[model samples]
Target chain A: MIRRLLLQHQRLWLLTIAVLGALFGLLLLLGALQLYFDFRSVLTGRSDLSQAQYIVVNKEVSTMNTFLGQKGFSTTEIAELKAVKGIRDVGALTGCRFDVNVTMGGGAIEGVPGMYSDFFFEAAPEAFLDVQSDRWRWQEGDSVVPLIVPKDFLRLYNFVYAPSQGLPQVTEEMLMLVPFNIVIKSKNGNVLYKGRLAGFSERINSILAPKNFVDWSNENYGPAVTAANEVKFLPSRIILQCDDASSPELAEFMSEKGYQTNSENLKNSRLSSLLRVIMNVCVGIGGLIIVLALLIFLLYTQLLISRSSYELQTLIRIGYNPKMLTARYMRYYGLIYLGILIVVVAVLWIGKSLFAGFMDEKGFPVPDGVSMPVVLLGVGFMVLFLVVNFFTVWLGLRKLAMPR
Target chain B: MQLNFRNVLPIPLADTPLPPGSLWKSDTSFESQARCLVQAPSGTGKTTIISLLYGLRADYEGQLLFDNQDTRMFSVDQWTEIRKQKLAIVFQDLRLFPQLTALENIQLKNELTKTLNEGRIREMAEQLGIAHKLEAPCGKLSLGQQQRIAIIRALAQPFELILLDEPFSHLDEANIRKAAELIMQSCTANGAGLLLTSLGGNTHFDFTQHLTI
Candidate 1:
């Protein structure tokens, strides 16, 4: 009965406009949140292959450096790069100072004919390697050295080199079974050890051996360090583990130092940052719309109370409790807010499902539903709005219902 | 509850010369269930006294007390409780919701108090001869009819005191007699006190006391 009396003077059009505005605002907020969640999951889920968080950086080789034979980084330069913002950890890519030769076939392998090749090998810290294998460890007495070849190198061999040379393509399983001899030759002495394929790396491009193995080999077989030949052992490439590969600070520091890395990785970082900025802007606009909608709703409630002020006063004069009247208005507006939030959540869920379905068709599977945080956020927004508007209504009615 | 007026002079009448028998600026007490007739000429604060006692106005010089408790000290909730269960009034201008039908106006009070059932309310309306007009909006009714609705609304609530300020100004003598009989019966049934104000003429109901305000 109190609701009926108070609602008598309510302008329907104003209520309709307020409800529509609130719906539009909340839907935009929840929709943007849902999209952000989906994009984040997709990015992180495929981060190993596509989003290279570990970037291998090297000083750009120049004619001046070539003439001076000063391509490797100095200790001071490596420390400075380690101190760069956003770089979490830095490890050098150590190159072999000794000669490496791989000899396959002639009883070394079961079926292949005799083949030999000179190969350059590099090793990095285990933390920076994308591939993990128990066989990657090398002890001093172990004669079999495990090697991780780049995935791109195998692709090039199978797709281009082998096809052109009319050679049979080898699968990774087949290659892993092949054990060949690695003959290391240096001025100190010569050593022959068996080598086996450990794994293929998607992140690092270099043919990788274990850091322990490289350190041992360099200490035992390499020449004594001289002023002119010292650069041969210095690290020319460094792998960086960064917190955000897309941080502009990392790119800026790299560019300022005349360093080079995979441009695609930086481009992917820029894309991620761009998505973050767009999401923030969308959320800002959504928040602004919600605030404006709440203001409109408050104004509408005030107008309704003011127009019905006489009736409310009369009711109070006849002994109607002000708190009871305030509760009535709260229940009315609370239900409206709840309905609006439920509709917004439903629409966002359906929209996300449709988008997920579309992405699935494109071979990119996104999660199918509104994320839990967004739903909780929506509920929080509804409660906040209800508290604000209900307080306004309570204040207005209490003032009007006061004795003159 | 007893109403105690101690040298109470409404702010508007602070400078006015008081008649010899006037209750203004005088220590007076009306105990519980004491039916008093407050007769005065026009512009003599008859409505103001009713307003002060009903807590509609606090702009007075002296203290007005309900059972020795200062009325000025009452909070809004306290006043609401007093109005809901202790005191009821028929305002000089019938303060009915114009948009509501006469029965709804009466039921608005009845719903809150729950003192009188619908049958009793309709019976009271029939006795006051406004039964047929109960379905009509109070705004569309005659002043006499609205006055009768206001009276029924006041009697529908439980109260220790019921104030009527010029309640029958628009009613004919015949309707006024019927309203007075109904008012007397409702007061007798509830064992309530009556504070009826008039502009000095023939007044109905034998009162326990009369005061010139």
Candidate 2:
């Protein structure tokens, strides 16, 4: 019998309900997907974010040999830098150049000059987990690990060559160049022995190898160093990853220990803040849409009340007094509100599944830890707000029930 | 219509209006008993009396009785249950649900009463000459048709007594006769007591009882 009454007024309910469900579902799905991707990137070190800031390293090049003497950052200095309060890790960075002599075929092939710098392998584990955890998949027998570069690097250099003709594709292998050299030394001249190339990166021109290997090789080679322009030494670029990024403890610690440290926390903070703003906008818009949807729902329900006033009056005439009227109408309100909530949840689930497919197409793998809880929380909030709003409207209409 | 008032109590009417002497002992034994249609005059407390009968007017000194029990012993909840199970009423204006179809308007009352009587609804519609407009919106129906639909809805409920206030206001002379006949037939079939208020000048149905104030 109730079904017949609803059917009598189906059009309005259908339109209002469909709109409510869609807004709630889309909000849930987008929030879940973004949270999932964020966690994945944080864990995998694939988030295109720079962890540190840079400072000027004065290189007094009285001669080319003196230029080599001012080798970026030594491994020993980096270790001491890590112990500082705000200094999380330190690394050496340099520019790239062509090798003066390396031939692959009959053609006069040039050897790729690699940027030899100190990399703090242990201090910043997340930065290398992508290669370290999955080393076996790409490792090959070589003293140095080959370079892995992104597809974009192809634009910087020509990788085209005919293997049969004995011409190499690209000589700028970031990984392989360092693996060929083994022993690495600290700034105080302590040395660490290393093995052959553990692996080659999938990315082109992007070569990442163990830190000890590169430092040792550069220390031994005098009057010459590759990637001179991109050198980073005792500077503010090191982020300690501690509670406070900007603290006097870090600056004093690095300065007193003969290790130069610059305060790049401000720059890093600015960048992080920018990223946080974008994230907040995405999530907040989802919440805002839900609020707007609830507003529309309230309006629709009010219209429903006006349209059904006569029916309510009829109920009154059918021996239903104020109390009975409240009970009967509340039951109806509860059912319709619950139905809308259920539909919203189901739609959110389906939309998340569809969005998962889209994310897969984009090749970013999101973990369950990030997706499930966010989805549940989003759906829960929507349902909660909707119920509160529904009860408020129902209560208002209850006041209109006349005594019999 | 403009109603004139005379001897209608200024404050409120309680069981016998303070007996015109002592302000105490107002029907002390009959607490739960409420009077309906005891008197009718254009403005001589007719609306107030109806309001009191429906329990809408609370400021009254009276011993209303239910089953020989005093009304004071019963709670508001008890009164509501009595209203739902034993009493029903139609308003002065034909408050037909505008969004509902003619059939739905009737079924709403039945459903609320927990009595799903679909067959009776269809039968009543056909007899009222509104069978063709059973599926039409109440807003689109003629005022006379809406009046019949309201009457049908009031009669379909499972109540001991049904009240009507200006029930046939929208009906023409012929339609009014038709509505009166149908209401009389349904009331007798259900054995439900009817208390209808209207101008006796135009109506032709003879009543078993009438008390003009």
Candidate 3:
């Protein structure tokens, strides 16, 4: 009956649908923003250190440091880096006090007792490390250590060391499966342990280990390093998570402190927050538009009921309850709102498909299936729309059906 | 099944279709099995009396009791149930939906009452001069045809009393006789009363009572 009645007013309904479509599209955009951020955050965690906003910042080697062998970044330098603005977090590197070597099966490399290559370790706090493969952690008594080598070292071995020594260069995958005995040596004693490859680092050009294992080993085999007011025991490099690499304030601060960053082209991960602000503005505007649209719809509904009040009053007089009258019109409007919801979902899916490649390039990929969060958000908005309009329609009917 | 009007005087109401006149200034009892008439000149509150009894107007001054219960205390649901199962009315303006077909207008009442099927409605329309006019929109029908449709619709429900205000004004004597016969038969079958109002002496039924408002 509502369909038959509304057919005469198709223009009115079409206008309503236009406004509703705009609202649905805005809500879908908000949902898409949520999906983009979540996917990007996940990808950032899974990818290399290249996407990390943090940089391994250190001071340049001066004449005093080269001549005096004072290569460590002092505690004062670490404090100054912490005080720098636009930096969210800071963690200094803890270095090993002993030389390290690795061999296969806890045995000698190439059947020699001491033919293993030279390597040392540095430990950054786990929060700063981008790659968190299960092989990256260590326990005190654990027989196996984890190796996060430098991609530069791998390339050098493949192109230079392999050709010079006539030894076959191995892939990262093969090297990962081969367990090597890690021997940590000091003037007091030498400790032998097994080690497995964790992953390669893209930014820092040093072998990295867990911070706990590094501190314990440094205490047991090397000179005791104080945490404050010391230069030799201090970190060699300070990593600061930058909000914006090109931010002039950060650039000025770095220049004033004579700090240089080895990780050039720092990923401006704070773009997420900026984009969130933009999306929130859009959502706020969308919310206001929705409110305005609802008011228009309410006024339109009142006009329609006013125009049809005679027939409605006649129906009410014919024993039709107010609930029946209200429900009949509500169901009609509910179906229209439901139609808007469907269109929103369809368009959002299409939008995701159209921008999948772009999002993937930005480290956030649109999934193939329907985005559940977007759909849920659309549903939420649809329900709110219906709930708000349901009252307007009911009030109109009550006004017309009841004695004024 | 009983309506009591006690010192009821019509008061002005906004958007009220009722005329400005009192129903009665004294107690009057209308029963389910009783037939009554309200005789008055045009615009003398004939429809106003019916509208007040129909619960369409509430601005009248005094008490109306349905089976000794005050009508004012009746909830909207109670009034709805009473209208659904007891009271039926044929408005003077013939308040049929203009967009609906004659058959659809009758079917709207039939849906509420569950008293008449399509076959019975078609039979009733055939008995009148309107079986051929049933499929046409009510707006397209002549006023006389719409009147017969309205009378058939009023009889389509189970009722304690059916109010017909100036129902046969548009119909000729022959069509009035036919519509009256149908209304009388339905009222008898349902064991209900009929309260009909008219401007002049045009009714043919053996009315049980008469009143001048």
Candidate 4:
């Protein structure tokens, strides 16, 4: 009975427009959220390192540096690079300063022939190494040295070098069991050490040994320093841990310092950042639309209250409680908002399924249903809208119930 | 249950010369179950008195209290509780939702109070000679019919006080007698006080006290 009296003067056209506006706004908001979720999953699936959080940078090798034999970063340069914005930490790729020779193949854990070649080694901090293995450790007196070789080296040998040389290719498990000898030649003497492959790294490209072993061997057998107190050696390359490799500030800093890194990784990072900015803009527009829709809903409520002021006053005068009237209005609009949420969810589910199928056909597979975060966001907005509208109704009726 | 007027005068009538023996700007109190009739001519703030007592208008010089609680300090919820269970009113304008049927107008209040069943509501409509007009929209009904509908709406609630602001102004002698009888019967049954305002005409119910405003 109270609903009949209070709603008699409501303008249905205004309400219908408001509801439509709410629907559109919610669809846009949830749709953008769902798309962001799918896009992130696709990116992570394609390549984990494509996020470009870790990058390797080096000085640009020019003719002047080559002529001067000065292709390494000094301590002051490393310190400056570490202080650059977006660069979290810097670890130098310390190269072997002593002459080294690796000999393998004849009875080296069942290889077919004898082979000997000069090899180079670089050492970086364990934190930057991607390969996790117990053997990738060494103490000063340990006779055997654990090494991490680049995975691309295995691919290169298997795909190009082995077939061309008429040699058999080996798997990673088989190579891990092989042991070779390393001969370190120094001004003091020649030292022989056993070398064993620990694991392969997909992130770093160098043949890596434990940092302590490299430092120990360099101190014992490396060439004498020009000065007694000069202990630091310049690194030719440095691997950086950065907050966002895509940030233009880092790029500008690198360029200003004449540093170079993998251009492909930077490109991918920039692409990801661009996508995020676009998504944020879309979400912002959706939020603005929702605000405008809420404003329209409030205006409609005010108009209804003023138009039905007489009837409301009559209801109050006849002993109808204002709270009861407000509750009736809340229930009515709550159901409408619930209906809007259901419609938005259904539409988003269908739209996402179709879009996911399209993406799958293009070799990018996203989740086939509406994401959980999107549903939660939609319901959260609905609840917010209901609360705002509820307050409007309550305030309007209270004014009518007790005019000041 | 008690009405206390402490030197209450409508803001608009503050500068005017009130008649002698008038209730305005005086400290007066009416105890529970007292039947009081206020007789006054036009433009004498009769409607203002009823509006003030019913928690509609607060533009007065002094305070109006309901059972020793100042009406000016009442919250919305408190006023609603008072209207639903403590006080009821039939406005002078006959503020009915004209789009609703006369039966719906009464049921609106009955639904909130739940003090009367549908059969009781129909019985009261029959007593007031409005049973035939119960199904008709209040907008199409005559002024007397709408007034009777408003009265039924007021009686459909439980109350300690019922304020009737010129309730029978448009009714004939026969209908007025019937309305007054039904109203007095409801008041006696509930042990509620009645404050009926009139424009100096024939009095229908036996009043325990009379005052001019």
Model 4 C-alpha lDDT per residue in residues B114-147, reported as the tens digit of each score: 8899899899999998899989989999999999
Compared with the true structure, what per-residue lDDT tens digits does model 3 show for residues A173-221?
8778876777888768788887888998876667888788898888888
Cα lDDT tens digits, model 4, A56-97, are 888888898777666578788889988887777899998888
User: What is the C-alpha lDDT profile of model 2 across A168-257, one tens digit per residue?
Assistant: 465434433333233333344444333333343332123444444334344443224456544432322232344334334544454455
Model 1, span A299-322: residue lDDT tens: 998898899888788887888878
- In terms of docking quality, how is candidate 4 classified? medium
RMSD of 3: 6.5
Query: Per-residue lDDT for A362 in model 3?
Result: 78
Off by over 4 Å in 1: A28-244, A247-265, A272-288, B6-9, B18-27, B209-212
Q: Please give the range of 10 consecutive residues that has the lowest summed lDDT in model 4 chain A.
A: A43-52
Better of 1 and 3 by lDDT: 1
Note the residue pairs that clash in candidate 3.
none
Report lDDT per candidate: 0.85, 0.50, 0.75, 0.84
DockQ of each: 0.46, 0.22, 0.45, 0.60
Clashing pairs in 1: none
| Quality of model 2 by C-alpha lDDT | 0.50
Best by DockQ: 4
Q: What does the TM-score come to for chain B in model 4? A: 0.96
